[model samples]
Target: MTRLDAVVVGAGPNGLSAAITLARAGLRVQVLESHAQVGGGLSSATLTLPGFVHDYGSAIHPLAAASPAFRTWPLHAFGLDWVQPDAPVVHPLDGGRSVTLERDLYATADGLGADGPAWIRLMKPLLDDWEGLLDDILRPLPRVPGHLLTLARFGIRGLPPADLLGRTLFRTPEARALWAGLAAHSILPLSTPGTSAMTLVLALLAHAVGWPFPRGGAQSLADALRAYLEFLGGEVITGVSVRDARDLPDARVVLVDSSPRVLLDILGERAPTAYREALTSYRYGPGIQKFDYALDGPVPWADSRVGRAATVHVGGTLEEVTASEAHLDSAVSDRPYVLTAQHSLFDPTRAPAGKHTFWAYAHVPGGSAVDVRPQVEAQLERFAPGFRDRVLACTVTTAPQLQAFSPVFHGGDVNGGRGDLWGLLSRPVPTATPYRTPVRSVYLCSSATPPGGGIHGMSGHHAALAALKDLFGVRRGE
Candidate 1:
């Protein structure tokens, strides 16, 4: 057999990306996955009923669409087609009203009424040079940023708590509610310092590249990535688990796309005490209890405009959304904030004709086993009256179940680890190169590394570049 140059463990987006990077550098590479399929969070399945395709993890792909690494690749040629909705997001309010984040910046701002100018003033500068902003933010921090001025501008606005920024920037309830919903994606409290960072990114991506998903399902994106990897001469082997160093193939370097704890287990005694301690101390944020529904018909949303967007923020008002996320550690709220996506509305392939699929989830305490279906459905019914009547089938996935499916989602924290200020800076361990471990030939390439979470695959891309430069003396563009 030909000698392998690199081995990437776990066939998540990161793993596949690492393999593709190595193979592109003219090195032989292989990927191992425990699951039968790739796309750790990007995978889809028939969770509810036949012909109803529900995304197991992420439902929307604003980040994936705008990812610098992904944009440069030919995923489109390998069956990756984006399904963009008329609007990127719709935040429903009381009294049958809704606000939308449109693909056109002015349209979205115009809908905000009194807060229109504030909205443009806040986003226009960053949106103007979004490509440069993404390039600097999507990698490790504390380095010489390619766009120093842009990074500095983002930091000044993003360092404040989302709640503070939302109140201080926008006066209207519509704008404040929209900002709160976007900030809540962090899975951290809206009041948490640095929560505004993700809020800004998500909103910017809406205008930069309307929130989209693959034409068929998120799995199509993964399948396309795998196909592209094969085209690059890299191989992927599923149903293979790499538990420890002994299980890894003979290769010059290994990139791990699992959690920090899993990485420690793989390293065993080879990792020094200090490094092991750092990995052990890594903290995870709140988990989520997700729901997938096979509906008999479209959700009868109170405001008809809500149907225009695939992504819906179901929690009302800034105060309501803030309270819902604020008490995650104590108890699940009776009216919890729900992040919902109605994919069948835009993609016919998601369900049988006239039928629809609903993907929604609410943040719960870490490793929570409690079922929050009642609360989730109540939120849905609150916004979309008669919504319960349309449900053909429902599949509930608890937080623990999510962790069981993939170790990367440790304690069901989808972003991998906490995304707070400290969490982002010291992810796994504070270092110039978080992907590089104490072992020279081994590296960590999961969301546990820099640019934590979301499906961009920059974690894997940066890790592969590191290994390429160190092990093969191959830098990017070589």
Candidate 2:
């Protein structure tokens, strides 16, 4: 009977973050992962081919660089390396013209021409207050103290009449396209309220700290975190799936980094009726299908700007992106919006010499079994005419296949659950403490909680603090 002060049953970024926090706080912590390895989305492997290590889910780490949690964690000293590419992203328009966002704000703004000043004005404030803004964005609804001030700044500058920010940001079509390109990262419709805020935050960080990838791969990040946890006397057990509380060792607290469905399926009657209803009533967002490609060389884009960027937003203009997103939710889009990342340009170690590794994915209806490769390739070719010829080998994961990989992605809803305004508010479920469940010591610390999705590990860290203080009377700084 190996009892522990805390046990986190999921070794994803959130789980490991939670475990590390608890262990550092003088608690005997242990992390249990269902998979053979850690870093749920951050895991890396030779998926496409040998000598080419591809990220399992997320590749880029803009949030990691900007996150207060990461800044305090000092992960770099633990063997993590950050690499910033020359260009952040390239958005291709018609007439063989494209816009590229670079590490310098002035450079990106200049590329947009007429909308240049507008881009700078809209992003400068948020960039200046990146840390303050992140605190408000990452915390739960009621816990955020500066929501009013933050919302006012965003509304006054970022939002437009009828309270829409995405559309009213830029007057020029190309500028609007650039804004849309940034906003699409949220995986929500451009009309949404928080969508614009998400856009400004990510864009600001792009220039503030720039998007960084670990030296080897995202797995290096996971491995570093895991190693630190062990250094503090914490333990990690992999390939051990917990279906019920009985499967876990006795502990003062238990945090689950999995989805509500996984918890409900196992805990069943043990879960309070109210929480279960909330989880059951939860609406999932659009599904996702992604392609991991191993190429002999980079994706040759007609516009030279495309080659300079590490990322490429494939959807055309504001209207085009909105229409495609709308069509995706409705399950029919001849031209879907796609997000592509060319990791090879930043880190040559991802592939063999003169070779590259590419990742692209599109949103679709939930539980959709669509192949999505043709649509994905077509969208890529829209920006890069001869993109198909660059493919050496590829692996396509359908929505169901992705869900099978990580049940946390229920129905392939990568944002954990629906990311709409209502969904964001009621994420996983609406509660004062979304991380705390009715199952006594058990808590939900995955992206399913407040500040849903993205690489930020606040959800786990916040949940751990609550569990420690509430469950074990372990006060911070005591």
Candidate 3:
């Protein structure tokens, strides 16, 4: 029975970030994870064929590189290289046409036709003040940062991605459809407020820092964090799942990198009645089905622009994406809004010299066990003719399997809990300290908390700060 100052359950990015922070603050910490490996959804592997590595979960890092916490940590000093591709994303339209968002804002604007000026106007201010804006949006909620004024100015009277792009800069169908493609990254309905924000933020990031992936793979990002934690004298225990409070070790602090339901189940009667009830009432948005393929070569898109991007959004039009999302809103699976990332283009190490690896997935009704590989492949085939021939082999992970790997991704809700306005506010619950829980000295640091879902790891960093302040009389190291 080894006692430690803190025990973080789950060794995902958030969990590792928390443990590393705590250890740097001179505390003894131990992390426990149910999976045999660390990194959770960010893990990488050679699944289908030898020498062809696949990102088991997330592939790109627009937010991770943009994270203040990640920047301050100096992960690059630990051999983690952030690889940037030529273009962040490419949206292929109905014809043999495509829209590409380059790292240069002016170049991207020039490609949008009549709406070009509006595109520049909307993004210029945000891009210029990105650091200040990010400080507000990514800061721990309930504590407004000094940049709140700037943040609110940008957020208020906002147009959603579809409408914003449609009315302002893009009269052309291709241009509007292009912005809609970026907006679909949120997986939210087209008209939603935060949906537009997500699109703009990602677009701004494309110009500011560009979307980057690790040189070795995304797993390298996780491995680097884990290494830092252990270097600071923290430890991780893999294959150990905590189902109840008794299953955990006694410590001055405990942070769960899991969903609300998992926390409720672990605490049982120990949790406050209200908190438990709120956990049960938690609303998870529609889920998704993911596919990882070992490809023989690049996807044969008619428009060569598709080959330049790290990722591609495969929904047809703004109205089509909205209609499909609306169907999912009503518990319909929708034809799977395909989000595909081709890492092989940038990292030749991901596959054989001439071959490539493909990662793709689509949204479905929550808890639906439908295998959507056929539908997704057919959709890809529409853009890239003979796409079926590119596949040497593939593996499809249903929603349940995804959930099994990361219970936090409940019902395969990839955006963590939910991204909608209501779900974003009340999810896991509304509280002054959203990360703190009923049990003393315990916290929730997973994406289920504020700054919901991404590889950013801010939730973990925030939760650790709270634990430091509450349990150990410390703050964020002035």
lDDT of 3 by residue, 101-185 (tens): 8899999888886777877877887788887787677666677566766677567524344555454656777677777777777
Candidate with best lDDT: 1
**Model 1 spans with C-alpha error above 4 angstroms:** none
Expressed as tens digits, the lDDT of each residue in 236-319 for candidate 1 is 999998888889889889999999999998999999999999899899989999999999999999999999999999889898
lDDT of 3 at 27: 98
TM-score of each: 0.99, 0.95, 0.96
TM-score of decoy 2 = 0.95
- The TM-score of candidate 1 is 0.99
Clashing pairs in 3: 115-169
The C-alpha lDDT values of all candidates are 0.91, 0.81, 0.82
Q: How many backbone clashes does candidate 3 have?
A: 1
* lDDT, candidate 2, 74-142, per-residue tens: 688789888788877778887688877778889888888888998888777766666777777777777
Candidate 3 segments exceeding 4 Å error? 157-169, 330-335
What is the lDDT ranking, best to worst? Answer: 1, 3, 2
Give the per-residue Cα lDDT of candidate 1 at 11. Answer: 88
